[model samples]
Target: MTIQTVTTTPYNDQKPGTSGLRKSVKHFKKPDYLQTFVQAIFNTVQGIEGSTLILGGDGRYFNREAIQIILRMAAAAGFGRVILGQSGILSTPAASHLIRQYQAIGGIILSASHNAGGPEGDFGIKFNISNGGPAPEQLTEAIYEASKGIHSYQIAPIQPIPLDKLGTYELHGMPIEIIDSVTDYMALMESLFDFDKIAALLQADHFKMRFDAMHAVTGPYAHRILEERLGAPKGTVMHGQPLANFGGGHPDPNQAHAKELMALLFARKSEFDFGAASDGDGDRNMILGKQFFVTPSDSLAVLAANATLIPGYRNGIAGIARSMPTSQAPDRVAIKLGLPYFETPTGWKFFGNLLDAGRITLCGEESFGTSSSHVREKDGLWAVLFWLNLLAEKQDSVENIVRKHWAEYGRNYYSRHDYEEIDLKAANELIAALLDKLPSLTGQTFGALTVGSADNFAYTDPVDGSVSQNQGIRILFTDGSRIIFRLSGTGTQGATLRVYLEKYEADTNKHDQDVQEALADLLTIAEQVAQIQAFTGREAADVIT
Candidate 1:
């Protein structure tokens, strides 16, 4: 096969966020758009020539085509070998494990995360480094720089390799190996969790749990682990097929998107003892109980407080880390356990250094993302399994366990309000105005809350000594209530302004109030301070979680 160097023009809009470059499928289908970006990654990653690469996607509409293109490009780029998941199916966490297990130079993950997927929907490409984590800011910046100046992309002149079967094939001098996507990941999970114990719990006549895959990538993983290996009933995993358009529904596993699952779990007489759901790429999760919801922040806290019950963490953890937007519940756990804690800006990449340096054993974000030193990327099924282990050991209802945790650690009432697809200019202006007002907000009182501090958040990574500034705006009150404003980068459309509200309550009697009702005053304070309605022209947030 001849190696073809096709000349191409660079696109300046390929700048990646913390998640990687995401755009509409139409934009990616443009001539040379995907090629330019892929070549830029190949050029930016040093020593890629004659090195290995792992490749796969979430089985979205464009997943297979993207895999074919990347495969040919890898062969032409002189890669020694390429490992692919069968039928181009791999969850974000699975891809991360493949990268680390093979010690490949890097892996390319094709997913829009929780976003919708279709011919007209969004598509994305994320490059994970040798550490099995998102590329750090420095490396992503280099890729962006290279993309801006790319002139050509290399590809082998060959037919598309069959990805349906598990086998080895040759492309030019590169060997392409297609492997079962779930086997290794299942083995890793089995190693971390007590499968036998969890199986017993799953098979118990009195206990029933449901795992909704949201018709995305986790269907196979959940089916294999929860149903096949653990002996749960056949229909225990809902939406258990990976659909190209995610069944024409948003794959986000929040209260809004996973409405069916939420309704079933929150029913007046719910049948299930435990409930969980995972997002598009299977990196994010939503945990629910009979007539109860466990906030991602509280879930992290509960897991950490009872982590030793699980075999993987039986020896105990080294430390804890959470995104700045995540509530301080886990921080309380870190304190009670005397383990060190660190808070960084949003993005899994920020936790990579900590996990690799043995500084943190568990890390998570408020946006339904959580994991540990087990895998660099967040693993949704893993989070579900962790909860299962806790359930089996504690032999308590999910609500009771959470309530006890709250009674011990004090409940941190937390919610995230997302105003998605707002005008880009308006969102930028709102943040600018917020920044201008930060200096004057401190010591001011809105309602019964007095501002303790107000500033744009910044962080310095202790492991690598790198600084990231302008992360978000934080308005912390003297009463331990907080309102945070940050523009989300994961969306492909117009900007998404995310407002985070948190309040700490030490009284167990006060924990039963509705989340929104508990923070009604703070919500008013947020609108008053940020002027969200006037700025974004939205009377209420589009989604609240």
Candidate 2:
């Protein structure tokens, strides 16, 4: 095999956000686009020669092609071995685990998580460090800098390697192993969760659960774990197949995207006792009961409070952490448990340090992401299994568990409104205007709510001491209500302005109120302060969750 160094030019728009470089598939298909970015990674990250690397994706369109390109690049870049997932399928969390379990140098994951997929849809790529976490800010920045000035990329000139079989193959003298995507991940999950207990709950005649993989990467994992291993009925896992275009449905595990699952769970006298869904890359999860929805925040809080019931956490957890935009319900749990708690920025990478240092046992984000020290990235199936173990041990309905939790720890009414695909300039202007007004907004009163403080969110990593600034703008009210504003880069076109509204209700009587209705005052105040409609011409949020 001959190693070739192809000349290339830098693409100016290659900077990655917290989720990595996501863009339209057409953009990535540009000549030398993907090659340039992959080469930038190999060039920037040191110690590539003769090191092991992991590679796979969610089996979306172009996933196979991307894997082929990266494999060839890795062989030419002097990697000794590459662990490739069968049929180019690997969920985000599973990839993280593979990186750590194998002690590889790092891994390159191809996914535009929760985004639409297809030739016309989105595509993305991100490098995870040896710690099995998203490359931290410093490394990502370095990759971006390298992408800007790269003039050539190295690749092994070879035919594509077959990825359907679970066996080893040679690619330009480097050993490439096509491994079963679910076995290692399943083993890890079984270790942390009481699968036997969960299996009983799943097999019980009185209880029925539905897990929607949304035709994304979690289908096989769910099938292998829930049906084949745990003995759930055959049809328990819906959309349990990895499709290139996600079966023409948006694969986000949210109320808006997982419509079929939500409809089934919300139906009158719902057939299923519990319902769960995972996103495209299987890192985010949405949990529901019979006509009951569990917010990601509440899910974290409930799980943390009852973690000792699970086999893995029987000895108790080290601590708890949540994203700054996440509700404070889990923080309250941490306080009650007398465990350390941390509030970091939105990315799961922020939790990596704490998890690595053993400062936090569990961490979550309001974006339907939750995970523990078991993996660096959020694990959707793991969250589902955690809930399953909790349900099996408690021998109670999901609604009761959450209601009881609310009664004990109080309820945090929270909602996030997203104005997606809006004019980029307008969204930037809106956030810029808010940043300028943050200083004066303090002590101001708006519609019976008095602002106690306001500022752009920032954080200093306790473990690494690295600083991340301008995370988001937040307004805190004296009544324990808050409205946060941030620009999301997960979209392919335009900008997505996300406004998070939260209010703490200690009165148990108000716990039954509808989430949007409970936060109505905060909603009005958020719009009044941000002037979202005026700035972006959005009458209402494109999606609310």
Candidate 3:
């Protein structure tokens, strides 16, 4: 088994974002594109030689090809073993779990994560460290720097091994194990949640829930957990099959992308009692009740408030954490529970240190991400099951649970407006102008709302003491209303500007109003603060969630 070193030129644009290196499939198809990045990751990671690496993907287009190439590279790079998922399928959260469960040195995941798939769509590669979390900023920066200067990559001269097999084999002196992707993940979920209790809830004749996989990676996960194990009806999991192109639909689980589920759940009278959807890699979730949409911010608060009801968190949570852009609803819950809470930047990697240090047990983001200390990455199905566990234990409707929460701690009328595919420089200029005026605009007024404070968000890691500045620009009103603006780091095209609007309403009666109507004043104020329309040339937000 001879190793071959193929000389190649470097690509300057292989820098990683909040998660990993993402680009269009065509861009990745360029000569030595994926190879160069893989080599860079191999060269940058600390003490990878003779280590085990778990490898898989989200079942997107070119996933199998990429898996084969990575296996060959791992063999030549002197890895002791490579654990590949059957059919090259492993959702993001599952990969994290496997990396921890097997005690592997690290892992590689191929996914674009809620982006479209296929030849024309997006593809991504994320590297996780020994702790089973996304690589930290310093490590990602090292990978990017190595990518810029890489000249060659090594690969074993061997034919592709069959990924469908279920046993271990030897390839180029490296042990390759292909295992069922769903089995271990299902087992992990069963341990964290009350399987017997959830089964009883699903068996109830009046209880009905819809789990929409969006034809992405969560399809098999949902089918196994919700239908087979829980004894729900066979048809409970909709779109419950992984497709390379995600059935030509965007895999994001939002009102805009998951129109069918949202429409059914938002109807005047929905047949189902609960509905849920997950993103492409199964890390992000959208939860809905009949005629109700629970904002992700509110969902985190509800989970924190009811943590003691579930088996896994019965003893109570240590603390909580949320991204800066996420609403302050969780803060209220944390205050009531007398638990410490930390606000980090927009990336999940920021929560790794907190979780590992045992400073926090639950962490989430406004981008439909929620998870506990179960694994480093967010788990979509886990959130859904947690919601189900709460619903069953209380014997209450989702709407009533949310209303009760609001009655206790007040409601946060929250919405995120996304401006997609706009000019990058124009968006930056808008931000630059905001930064220039942030200090002077504190006392100014936007309509009846008086600005109390404003600043660019920053964070000092409590565990490591590292500081991250310029996270986002946020303006707070006197009455606890907020408007936040930030450019997205995950898009494949032009800049994507996300405007987050939030208004705290203490009156429970006011919670029944439409979302846009509830935040109308903040919406207008956000545009006025950022000059969104004038700079981006767009009238309405592409997606509001």
Candidate 4:
């Protein structure tokens, strides 16, 4: 192995956002922009002159181009080997699994998650640590600092490796192995789920299910798992293609983006018993029942309550966790199980330490992300498989099972309304104005609604004890209801204001109301509590999730 350095000018906007360095393709095409960031990643990590690294992407636009650049840089940086997925396309969860399977030093994933993709749209490059999770804060900070003052980046003028072939090649004396993209991942799913049982359920016509892939990375995975493995009809999976532009759709599995699936569910009504979809990169999931939408909050609780039915969770759940802005349903389950319950700041990395420390077996976010000890990251396909296995074991309809759960333990009604792509300045003004009035809002009383408490949420990691300030703001009512406001960290441009509403109702009579109707009053209060109109200068939200 040889070490070298080459001088280059630094580019602005190299700072990574919530996940990674995201920008338009033109931005990444600037002089030495990608090289500088790649070099900074290499420079930040130590003892990687000849270590194995993993490389792959979500097959978005610029994926192949970025892979070539990264290959050249990795060879120049003296990496021993690179394990890449065939066709240079690996869903986010697949890449995480490959990183852990190969025991690579780290992995580079090219994706902007559910964001739009094209030459003119968003592009991203995220680094996952050796533990198969997103790079920790310390490592990300180091990479950012290196990017700031970078004067040069190293690269070899070598021929680009052919990523489409499933074979081994040599690039500057470094081994590049392209493996079957879905084989190992499918095998892992098999180990975690009982395919034979699910097959029996499908063959017996116990339930009718529909799975939408949204034309993103999970298309193949869904086809294999739902159709081939589970013995469902080939047409059971919809939108089964890996389109760079995600078929001109948002590729998010939520109700707003997956309206087609939602309509199909409602049109057929009782025909389909279960419906589910995964977002781009396959890290987020939305689970729906026939004519019933299971909020992410309720989804996590249901999964936790029935975890033992799945072989992977048979040892009993180690613990449970949820993002701070998510409803507190899992906390109640954790209490019942006598296990730890963690409330961490948003982002999947916050749960990494707890997962590594064995403090939690299951964790989820309100943004339709759910996972357990099966993997470090939230896996959309995995969550769907969990629901399938649960359904197979219980032999009941999704709605009936959920209704029974509510009957036994009560119901926690929750909803998150997202105002997407608003002006940054306006969003910040709204948050600032709300913070200024927090003191006054703490003790005020309005009709039947009385403020019980209020404050900005600040988190201190239990395992590492790292503190994250100004996460979000919350206002609790005296009647066991609350409203939370925060700007979404995953958006590509403009701010996304997320307003979460939670109210606990132990009465079964009122549990059957529509969610939007149930939260109608709180939605109004949330708009007023945050002064959304006065701050953002917009009367209506762009989207509600």
Candidate 5:
């Protein structure tokens, strides 16, 4: 294979966010903007002159066009082969699965995960490492440096390779393999879960359920699993289509964006016993009951407690982890099991090193992501299936099971309120101000609240001893109540400030109340401590998860 190079100038917005380089479509459409970054990825990585590359995207706006450009560029960059999904549509987890299954060098995932998509919306390109995890910090930094002074991007003058057929073809004498998008992924899921039991549970009508795909990438996977594979009726899956615009929906599976489905469950209250949804690229997830919401913290705890019920996890869990901002529910479980409990930085990438080194088996974040050793990246549909399998084994309703778990282990009341798209500079100022006051806040008493400690979080990766500073600011109270504040890294526009409140009550009498109402007093203290209202100029949060 012969390689070619084309000279070009650097584009300014190549800095990757928490996930990857995400920005408005217009930002990516600049002359040589996408090409410059893609070339930087190839040049910075090793052994790509004649190696296999996997390519696909979330089927968002500009996805197909970007795939075409990338294909030509991959050929020109001297890749020996490219494994692409049909129509270049692969959910994030599926792409990760493909890379691991085929042992490809790495893959380019075209997605601005959970961000809106359309001609006028957003687009993103992320490179997954050979292990199917997001590129580690070093690689991302190298790519960023390369983007700063990129002088050339290589692409061959060739017709667009057809992606609809599942067969092998040759481009510039390089092999290109188009694989069935669902086959390998489905097989993997079947191996990990008990499909027979899940099907039996569906047939028994043990519990009515609804899955909303949010008009994004998970629509097909949801439909195939719930309707075709598990024998759910066709309409049980909602918004089952892949639209560039996400059918005018936000495509985020949080309470704010999925209010419609939430309202339906609350109103009917009879047809649905379980409710779940997946985000745009199929990584984030939200799970609920008819009138009961499963806080992400509680969900992770329950999954960790019952992980042995699943076929793949029947040997007992290896370890558990949660992002620093997430509540300490899993910590309680970890203590019980004598397992290693880890607290990492917010992004899912942090868990990859742990999983790769066998230091942990399961990890989750407050951002509605959960996964295990099954895959490096968070798996949304996988979480749903896990809950389903648990339901089958327990033969109990969602609320009942959660209530029982709380009764046994006590409750960790938790809530996260998000102030979206605030001025970035002002938000940073607010955080800095809070960090400066940490010393004053520590060991102080105000009313019934006595501050136990306060500090800015710094993480030292146990395996490598690498340090990550400024992960977030945290305040702990003598009463076991805590609050954390940070700027969200996944937002596409202005900064998003997230405040997480947590309190543990060992008393069963007060366990069943609503989370926000339970944490009302702590919320007041949090606002006062951080001066959140004055800083953001908003009295209330945009969304609470």
Candidate 6:
């Protein structure tokens, strides 16, 4: 094989957002676009030679093509070994586990993470460090700086390597080990969960579960673990096949995107005991029971409350952490357990340092991200199994479990309203006006609530002592209500303004009210405070979750 450096110019828009460098597939298809970003990653790491590089993706449209390019580049970059996933399929969580399990120097995960996918849809790539977590803000900034001044990229002149075969293959003298995508991840789950108890529950005649993989990367994982190993009846897992286009639908597991499984669970007198769905990369999960939709915040609370009942958590957890915008339910649980609780800024990357230092055993976010110390990235299937393990041990209905939790810990009525595709200038202006007023609003009143504290969010990493400022703007009311405002960092088009609303209710009877109605007061105050409709010229939020 001959190594060659190809000349290319830098693209100013290659900077990564909340997750990674995501753009329209057409944008990535521009001359040397993907190569440019990959080369930037190479330059930032600066130690690719003699290091093991793991590569895989969510089996999206450009997955295999990207893998081939990266493989040739890795060879030319002088990596000693490259671990490949069979058929170029590996969920985000699986890739994280592989990075740590194999002690690979780092990894390249090709995923847009819940974004729509196709030739006309979104595409993305993020590099994770050896700790099996997304690159921290420092590294991400370094990559962005590198992407700006790149002049050339290196690659080996070599033939294409077969991606579907499971064996060792040589490409440009670099050994590529193509392995099963599900086995190692499943092994990690087996160690943490009581498989025998879950198997017995699934074997019961009356217990029924519907797992929607959404035609993405979790198909094989859910099928093998839920059906083959746990004795679930055939066809319990829906969309159990990985499709490049995700079967022509956006593979997000939200109610609007994953309507098939949601319909079955919402149907009158639905017989299914539980229903769960995972996003394109299999890291975000939405869980439902009968007609009940469990919000991500409540789901984390229930899991923490019932930790000891699940075999994996039999030994108990140390502490808990959650994104600042997340509900205060976990704090209630942590308080009950007398464990330390932390609230950090948005993004799963913030939880990695805490999880590693053993300061927190479980961490979650309002964006349907939940996981423990078992893996750096959130695991959708892992959360599902943890719920199942609790259910199997408790022998209670999902409704009962949630009602019981609220009865003990009170309920946090939480909702996030997102204004999508707003003009970038207008959105930034809205936030700027709010930031300017944050200091004066300390004692101001909105509707009958007095402001206790109002400021933009910031955090200092406890383990690494790194600081991140200006994360989001938040207002706390004297009545224990909260309203948060921030622009989302995960979209490709115009800005997405997210307004999070929450109010705590300790009365059990109050928990029965509609979530929107229960939060109506806070919602109104938030709009009044931000003049949302006035600034964005929108009557209502684009999406409420």
Taking all chains together, the TM-score of candidate 4 against the true structure is 0.96
Better of 3 and 6 by lDDT: 3
- Which 10 successive residues of model 4 have the least lDDT summed? 1-10
Better model by lDDT: candidate 1 vs candidate 3: 1
lDDT of 4 by residue, 1-545 (tens): 44356789876567776678888777788877888999999999887888889888877888888899899899988899999988888888888898898888889999888888777777889899988888877888889889888998887775878787889998888899999888888999899887888888776755788899998888888888788877888788999888888888887889889988898787754688889999878889998888888888888998998888998778788889999888887787778778889888888888999999998998999998998766678899999888888888998888898898887667888888788888999998888889998999977876578899998998888888898889899899988788899898777788899898888777999888887787788888887777788877777767776
Q: For every model shown, what is its TM-score relative to the native structure?
A: 0.99, 0.99, 0.99, 0.96, 0.97, 0.98
Each prediction's RMSD to truth: 0.7, 0.7, 0.9, 1.7, 1.5, 1.1
TM-score of decoy 3: 0.99
* Model 6 regions lying over 4 Å from their true place: none
lDDT, candidate 1, 410-430, per-residue tens: 999999999999999999999
Number of backbone collisions per candidate: 0, 0, 0, 1, 1, 0
Computed on alpha carbons, the lDDT of every model, listed in order, comes to: 0.94, 0.94, 0.93, 0.85, 0.87, 0.90
- 10 residues in a row with least lDDT, candidate 5: 263-272
Stretches > 4 Å off in candidate 4? 1-6, 268-270
- Give residue 484's lDDT in candidate 3 (0 to 100): 93
Higher-TM-score candidate of 3 and 4: 3
